[model samples]
Target: MPLYFYSTREPYGEFSNFALYGVKIDGEWWPTTEHYFQAQKFEDAAYRRKIRDAHSPKLAADLGRSRRVPLRPNWESVKDDVMRACVLKKFETHSDLRELLLSTGDEEIVENAPGDYYWGIGKDGSGKNMLGKILEEVRAKLKNAAC
Candidate 1:
């Protein structure tokens, strides 16, 4: 069976970007993968900082989705890589999260986000679930490193 995750209150919630896992990247600490991923959408350092310092992941996402500040032209091309890096760093930083991810043992991970079709399974379950794919990729990398 696939592992479905969405809210931070549910099982496998740790896999969600909204989970409370802080990662240090580029000499700065991000409160969660959501914060890091959202902030990277822009080239503007000040704007990035604003997203990074958001009080919560949801607020950071809101800021990221805002078009007020133009996204970096390369955002679409590089978003997956950025998410991969953030997820990898997050799992790498927290041993408990690593163990929990590995415990799934090759199960297909799905982000059960009804509203987000790209990073999750949409309402009809046809969404791309890119976040789940990224987690699985990170799981494989961590598993291999442990061998």
Candidate 2:
């Protein structure tokens, strides 16, 4: 199975990147982003403010308020919706990703996160593997969408 990076909102183990980072995903893996800011039009008020603050002048007189203020930290609840959108978008655009998923037989695909024993197979390969289940559900949705 091919391994790819799937960004996480928070770091896991030694794999940490605050500015921007990617998580490792196998062939059964899916990638999604949680950057509530970047996922917007640049010209939008909040996005523009983020850009402006990041590129602000050093002078106090030139300092402008940034609209990059954090929103409610409810990613845990919102992530499923985000993931669904990502799966649909990827299936629509990335032919390789779509082919990888479509190539699967009736067998349930498992994407094991290396460090997550509850959500992935543990070091001994025994766990709930919820992410894998989510992938399966997303795949089914995609298949139904195509029909």
Candidate 3:
């Protein structure tokens, strides 16, 4: 049984603080978090691009008439944003940033991510990957750590 932190809110709600989890992929406990980071990086870039051009001129003027407002990426949004931006160099489990930190408790894992979001493994995740196609972005982020 894999142990991890789980958010208590429902999907689209606030993130959970901590929890425990399990999986059945290839009889493996979890997916991984390597490529997940890359995925997150790309996601953020894409998100910025979206909002940058999405604002209406009227609303933009009302908000700020003479100044540019570069809104910072929200922590929650960045988690998935960074994952989408990274191109796949390699795919592996142990390489996952989340897995490495969770399994080994290494601080270096946080630095490995593109932007530096340090949220670690969850106990009840479905092993989603960064592609956002998968449920675990961190799992896919550790491209080099998997064996």
* Structural similarity to truth (TM-score) of each candidate: 0.99, 0.47, 0.19
Q: Candidate 3 has what TM-score?
A: 0.19
Count of backbone collisions within predicted model 2: 1
Report the CA-based lDDT of candidate 1 relative to the real structure: 0.96
Which structure among the candidates has the greatest lDDT?
Answer: 1
The predicted structure with the larger TM-score, 2 or 3, is 2
Q: What is candidate 3's local distance difference test score? A: 0.29
Model 2 misplaced stretches (Cα beyond 4 Å): 1-71
Q: lDDT ranking from best to worst? A: 1, 2, 3
Q: How much lDDT does candidate 2 score?
A: 0.42
Error of 2 at 138 (Å): 2.0
lDDT at residue 102 of model 2 (Cα atoms): 61
Clashes of 3: 55
Worst 10 contiguous positions by lDDT, candidate 2? 11-20
- Compared with the true structure, all predictions reach lDDT values of 0.96, 0.42, 0.29
For residues 17-96, could you state the per-residue lDDT of candidate 1 as single tens digits?
A: 99999999989999999999999999999999999999999999999999999999999999999999999999999999
Please list the residue runs of candidate 3 whose C-alpha ends up more than 4 Å from where it truly belongs after superposition: 1-71, 87-118, 121-147
How would you encode candidate 3's per-residue C-alpha lDDT over 1-147 as one tens digit per residue? 222222223331111111111112223222122322322233244543332332332232233222244334563566454433322222232134244333532222111112213333223333331232322343444534455
Off by over 4 Å in 1: none
